[model samples]
Target: MGIVRNGHEASDRWSYIRRFLGGVAGIADDFLGWWWRGKDTLSPAELAAAHEQWADRAEWRLAQRAEELASDRIKRYLVTSWTDSVAYTSRRLAAQARGELSEWIPQRERRPDLHTEARAIFADILTELNIQSQPTKEQSSVVHLRKAG
Candidate 1:
């Protein structure tokens, strides 16, 4: 009976852990999507959902892993989650700073204006993404601002 009970307990633990891990993986995916919202062409609601999902997943992962892993693993996960969140937040902040990415339309109507708009937006996006700097008065990283010729 002891062996049988132990087997059942192990099975239950495995099932719980598997579900927890699945949730973590799902959140990680959502975080990636949210981070790459501009690049991926996800809708606003979709992006929001991704952010929420990632938060949920990270919280769940932390709670579950808190008990099982060595303190180092828990710390690693915490750091990983924090870094991922920062990356996602930074991407969104950068996109918002660019202003051209207000609405990320994946299938833009192929008009001549679309090309011009995309070029401008791309330049702005690249500037924000490429040029890393300290936050400015506006609390956003300084990207090169084109002076009026």
Candidate 2:
């Protein structure tokens, strides 16, 4: 019965992990919907549809990345690390969405460097998905101001 009990315990642990991962994935989806809201003028339903598309693309990209890793263990670790990062970022974004926080960075100040980094990540995803990037008003003004300066 010890062998059966060990197998059951392992199965239970795997089930718990799967559920936790699903919750994190949901949080990431929620955060993406919130982020897309400020980027586009789409209605909530349309934004949700777009979010689904983007999520699928992201998953595909992540799978491709995982496949590049040398070992199955390393691939699993990479995917878990990526999932945890996304969950943490999503929590921060959700706080911002609820007006509990001001940017991801403190100080009520904009971080152009971080913004650029984020845009580059999104640009890669967009390029992979064959979607065009839309410049925000702030992005457009920054270009104009740079030219003027």
Global lDDT of each model? Answer: 0.43, 0.44
List the candidate 2 regions with Cα displacement exceeding 4 Å: 1-38, 70-72, 81-149
Candidate number with greatest lDDT? 2
Pairs in steric clash, model 2: none
TM-score of every model? 0.29, 0.29
Clashing pairs in 1: none
- Tens digits of lDDT, candidate 2, 1-149: 11122122212322212221222222332343445444355454444443343334335436545645546543454464464445445445334444455445431133354445456666776796773466778899999999999
- Candidate 1: minimum summed lDDT over ten consecutive residues — where? 1-10
